[model samples]
Target: MSQPLTGVKVLDFSTLLPGPLCSLLLAEAGAEVVKIERPRRGDEMRSYEPRLGEDSANFVLLNRGKRSIAIDLKAPDALERLMPLIREADVLIEQFRPAVMDRLGLGYAALSAANPRLVYCSITGFGQHGPRAQEAAHDLNYVAASGTLSLTAGSDGAPVLPPALIADIAGGTYPGLVNILLALRQRDQTGRGAHLDVAMADNLFTFQYWGLGNGALGQWPGTGTDLVTGGTPRYQIYRTADGAFLAAAPLEDKFWQRFTELVGLDAAALDAMPPPQATEAVRAAIARQTAAHWEQRFAGQDVCTCRVVGLEEARRDPHFGARGLFSRTVATATGERMAALPVPIDAAFRATDATLPSPALGADNPLLDH
Candidate 1:
């Protein structure tokens, strides 16, 4: 069966995380993604550690199934060379700072003239024409600037770094992908295109919708002091006797009651407002047994409890194996095969290619010909 995006073409002029990730999803959905990279050096992610062939494993994983074309935008003929692809492309993703594309004559205005149906997306730390539009930042900076980082904390009451790139993936890549698809749908109806400005920092606020409403009510949650952020006995992590952690989130009253019963705690302990003592009691009870013991005890219960396993353990679990997530593979330069990075797209929209490889630099540069 043909995929939904089987005929869509994407010109990816972005490097590193957000834009490349977005284009990767498009490619997985059967879009023809042609990555435009800097000449000679290619994407900087190729320099990242733990080499796979000549490029980093990170680069190989993120760029699998996409073709590459190396070109120096500063060169006089660069625009001319890219014009064909730009006109043919249905979607274009770029992450340069504001006005940088204009300097190279590749801004939305210039490209839209050549292809009126182009859905051009710009991913940045701050949006175009903002006070901090040109300010250099990464995932951490975007989270900090958005106030979402303040919600991350431990018992020490100090803010903890997030385990993932919250801003890059959740904010930029996801929003860019969603808006690009929406713009394409709108074009189908209106016979026009859109220039989307996706700012990672601005988009991070959507993750804090609850916090925003709380602030509107003059009840803003502080660091580590909210229902979902480790403040309540109903939703907190407790250490087992074996030193592993059990993440429990029985937020509803029924589940909380079941959790308290299973943990051998007095249900009234949590009924007291601002449950510091109740939380400590819950912690003490959990610490009395190993994670395995609690796993058995909590099994088949309404209490949402599970042991926190390491990445390797999680990957090797039977559940994920049964789901066929790792059935698709990408090969290293040496032909060593591993699971492909799991994409969020439904498998029905992706080809059943058993294995794919990342393209060599400029491997598809011959596309320039008429």
Candidate 2:
């Protein structure tokens, strides 16, 4: 029971972030993942800057623990060659736009005929048969189209660009993995596979549940409007005297009382005041002290107030190390190593390999012959 997917075989036909990250999770859980890449250049991510040895750091991190098989799908013999692998693959993941796979003769209907039990997963920005299905899009575009960007306002009265790729990872990768696992489970009972169309834009509505409900009630929630959207002093960011930002979210009355008291504010007066005026008071109080001063005051306090640190400081946090978040490692072809990209999968499901190497172009091509 150490690794549940010990005998599962995954044929990864996607690249870049979402699809590769999804396959990485399966590979970590002992799935034999064979990454199908184009010949010569392989995944375009391999050429991205910030190289980690011969491959881009992104490619190395995302494709870790997977074997590579290079093939030119445009070749006349391509479908003939892929037939063997398709017949044996338990899962096939692709992120090409609608009908692109069908043109290449590798569509779900085509491949599922070869292996009736294949769980075919297709991740795209829209879907297989929508007006915007063929439109090219990135994470930002998806978020914008899904009404998420409208709520993320910045100080300049414009939407703030998210630091993380919410649409790619949360919208696409997670949903892709969940559906693939569910399809596999269903196959175990019915002995038939399914075609999963995971649309990143469509999946985004799930994260906007609160806003949707409020909108349905005609309140129309947005940045600086909803409670969680900084409508109240209780859930807002403040600038400290030392130029550090404190993300404070003491939404409950008890936490808000504690927070106001810690910052030397009259809790009753602030509560009686309008939200805008109350926010101004809290901001003024926080601006009177350095981040270090408040960090010390709020150290063990349950007021939900803390100084925000840069990415480097957050990465070096002792809490993550104590939890063995970076215990696993990824190695380069020349044997250099770095901490592997931490995945959300539980450690119990990971195989006992301390380090795994990302594949070189066509490293597992011989498997194509067998």
Query: Candidate 1 on 16-129: residue-level lDDT in tens?
Result: 999999999999998999999998899999889988788888888898889999999999999998898898999999999999999999999999999999999999999987
The candidate that wins on TM-score is 2
Q: Cα lDDT of model 2 overall? A: 0.92
Error of 1 at 110 (Å): 0.6
Q: Write the per-residue lDDT of candidate 2 for residues 1-370, one digit (tens) a residue.
A: 6598888999999989999999999999999999999999999999999998899888888988999999999999999988988898999999999999999999989888889999999999998888999998999999999999988897676999989999999999999999999999999999999999999999999998998898899988878877887788999999999899999999898998899889999889998999989999999999999999999999999999877889789888999889888888898766767889989988889978789998988999999797
Best by lDDT: 2
lDDT of 2 at 11: 94
- Candidate 2 wrong stretches, greater than 4 Å: none
RMSD of 1: 1.2
lDDT to native, each model: 0.90, 0.92
lDDT of 2 at 83: 90
TM-score of each prediction: 0.97, 0.98
